[model samples]
Structures are given as C-alpha cells and as structure tokens.
Target: MPKIALHNRDGSSNGTVDLDDAVFDVAVNVPAMHQVVTAQLAAARSGTSKTKSRGEVRGGGKKPWRQKGTGRARQGSIRSPQWSGGGIAHGPSGEQNHVKRVNKKLKRVALRSALSDRARSGDVRVVDDLVFEAPRTKDALAFLDALEIGSRRVLVVMAARDQVTGRSFRNLRRVHLLTVDQLNTYDVLVSDVVIFQRAALDHIGKGSRPDLGQRGRRPSAGTRSDDADLGQRGRRPSAGSRSDDADLVLTGREQE
Candidate 1:
C-alpha cells in the first residue's frame, strides 16, 4: 500500500491517505500506455487533410495535344500527376479513418500503470475536496499556489461535479480539472503533478492503508475462490468499478 500527504486548500497538511495498490502500485506498462494514448488522440483528429487525385482535378477533360504527333513526349491530360499543376498522386484523402481501438480491460491496466508510476515518482497528491463558494479565477490560482504548483501543469481529479471548482481552475491554462470519470492516462502522464480530491478517491478507491478505512487490498494470491476462475482470465477486473477505460493512451495526445 502507498500513502500520500493530504493537504488543505491553504497549503497545510491535513493528514494522509492510502492509494490502492491496484491503481497506484502496479508496474508501469509503457507499451500499453502508448497504444491507448495513440488511439485516444487519433479519435480527436478530424482526418480532414485532403488532396485531389488526377481524375478528380478540373480541366483534365481536354488532352493538351495529339499523343502520336506530340514532339516533346506522349501526352495525356494536363492534370496528370507528372505535370507541375497536376493533381497529387498517392496523397492524403480527407476520408481516412484515424481511429484505433484499444481493449477496455487493457486500457484500465495501462491507466493504473501510469498512475502507479506517478505515485512512485512522488507526483501524486491528495487534497480536501475543492469547493468554491463561487467561481473565481484568483481563488483557483491561489489554491494552486497553496499546493505549491502555482505555475506547474497539474491534473486535478474531482469526485463529483463542482461547477464552481471547474470555473475557478478553467482560467489557469496549465491546470486541467476533470471529474473522476474523465480521469485518463494521457492527462495523468503529461502533468507534473496529479492531485485527487479526498472524496474523489471514493470513485477511484483511495486504496489507502487499512487504518484509513476498508482494507482496500485485492484478495491475496494465497486465497482462491471457486468463482475466481469464472471471471475473465489474464485481466485484473476493474474490481467492478466504472468502465471508464480509455479508447486510446498517451502516445501522441500531447499535440494539444
């Protein structure tokens, strides 16, 4: 089990929380993360890059000269690919399908791998719920300053909707705020620090040390239930958690 120092919005340490080993103690899967991130970013691409083929170009209906008598060379339409102003050959079409698919189960594993890496690198932090009486950019800035990430890029995970919190952080270009459901490997890997609201841990499971609450441990390897074999083999179930696996991982997502 791993633990992080919990802090108040004002820069003071409140206590500590345990992180779920399943979520933040697993080995980093670079290949899996790369695959998922690449797919996710591909989905965002408009894939609108386009070029006209020779057949599609205008004014190609007329042949420049008689092919048999042409002195320079045999000629077809002026719009042929060999010509200076001719349509492109083997160029990009606007209809390309850039999307790639990643398995839901593999995506989760990759996400956990990324989060675990962050934990190991000492970039994961926990904070009291970020609630704002009203949305204020200054307050958001101040809040981040308190966390000592005033100018650092950060990923904040909220357990639930908090419009005020969203508004406050929205003004900070470097701070990305997302609900627990929106949490993904791309954001977690790109940011300098990953912060989670105390309540948000419930959604992702604090996986904290037992003293914090439930013994958030997976069944020991020594203990095998009869139904264990019935579940999917070779995949760590999200433990019946939300199916928020990413369609892609972090390979090219940083283009934004």
Candidate 2:
C-alpha cells in the first residue's frame, strides 16, 4: 500500500490516504490488459445476423415449366433463387450471434493491472472528501481546481451514490463517475487521472453505501413504482384485443 497527501479546498494538507497495492502496485501486464479489453469490447457486440437461402424464398411454390420444355430450356419457379426477383442464395441476413466469452477472474486481473499501471505513474488522485453545500456546477469545478485536476479527462470514483455529483458533471466534457467495484478497464484506460473521495475507497470496495438523494424534485405522477403499477392495472382493454372476433365475423360473411 502507498500513501498520498490529500489536499483541502484551500490547497492545505487535508490528510494522508492509502490505496490497495494489489490493485494499484502490481507490475504492468500489457498483453493481459490488451486481451481483456479486446475481449470485453467484443462481448458487447450483438451477433444478430442471418441469411435467407434459396429454400426460404417466397413466391416459388410451383415449377415454371416441365423438365422437357418445347425447344426452350427447362425452368423452375420465377421466385427461385436462381431467377430475378428471387430470394438470396446463401447471402447473409441479420440474425447471427457474435459474442466471445472470457474468464471473469482474468478480467479482474486485467483491471487490477491497468489500475496498478495508472497508480505507478502517479495518475491516481485520492481526495479527502467532496463535500458540497449544494449540487452546484461551480462547487464541483472548484473542487477539481483545488486538486489541480482541472482541464484533464477525469474519472471520479465515489464512495457512495451521489446523484447530485453525477448530474453536475453530466454536462462537463471528459468526466465520468464510477463506484469502486464498478471500476473497469474501459474507464481506467480512457481517463488521464482517477479521483476518489477518501471515504469512497472503503465504501466502493465490497459493501453497500448510501445513495445520495437527487437535488431536484421528481414528477408526482410517476414518483413511485406502486403507483405506476396501479395505474397500469386500472386501464381498460383496447379494440386490438378483439381482433380474433373481427376475423371470424369477416370469414363468416365470406362463406355466406
């Protein structure tokens, strides 16, 4: 474990902070990092691809001509894959899967490796705490300035869920927030520096933390889940639900 001096709002020494050496001090493993990142990115892609073969084509139910044509070549249905306006012949459609599996432990190791590399380079910033009187953008900016981390891409690792803190930084470019356990290689590699509130280190590790309430009030109509459920259950059925009856009536009229 390594200790770093956290600074106060006025640029004074706030306190000392210790980091998890296993995550921040391990030797850099470039190969492992690359593999993990590539694998994760690959896993995120949707493999929804398919192709319509000749057999799946429409409007090709009957043969166009007999096997022995009169002076002309034998023919099949016009909608056959071999003919114009026909379905594709083994051409790729859009319904295949393209997911790759990777070991979870290996992914964790790669994340730790990336964190260690960043830590070794002095790119990790540990802050005493980000206490804001209110959820103001200026207050957040001031904190960033106090730590001399302004103007750089930042990933703020918080100890607990702070909706105000998250929302305040939403409009800012190159700033992100993640809880400790939620830390991943994508975020760690994308940012130039990682900032964590002092208490966040322990809170983000393994247990549940308090959710910082939202700054603004929410709409009253959809405020709670139970209310939404009740409203949905109270609604009447629609005309679409009688589609079967309508179809039966239409068929009866045709028969008559």
Error of 2 at 241 (Å): 40
lDDT tens per residue, model 2, 1-256: 6877786654568777766665567677788768766655554444545656667766777887777847777777777677878768777667554444555555556666777777888888877766555667677777778778858888877665556666665555566665444456755776799887777665533233334332111112222213210111111111111111111111111211
The reply for model 1, stretches above 4 Å from the true place, is 68-71, 206-243, 246-256
TM-score of 1: 0.77
lDDT for each candidate structure: 0.66, 0.57
**Model 1 lDDT tens row, 1-256:** 7888989988799888878766778888899989877766665566679999998888878878887855778778999999988999999999887767776777877788888898999888898868888889898788888888757678877665566777676656577665565567666777789988888775566322112221112222222223311112232222212224422221212111
In model 1, state the lDDT of residue 144: 81
**Poorest stretch of ten by lDDT in candidate 2:** 228-237
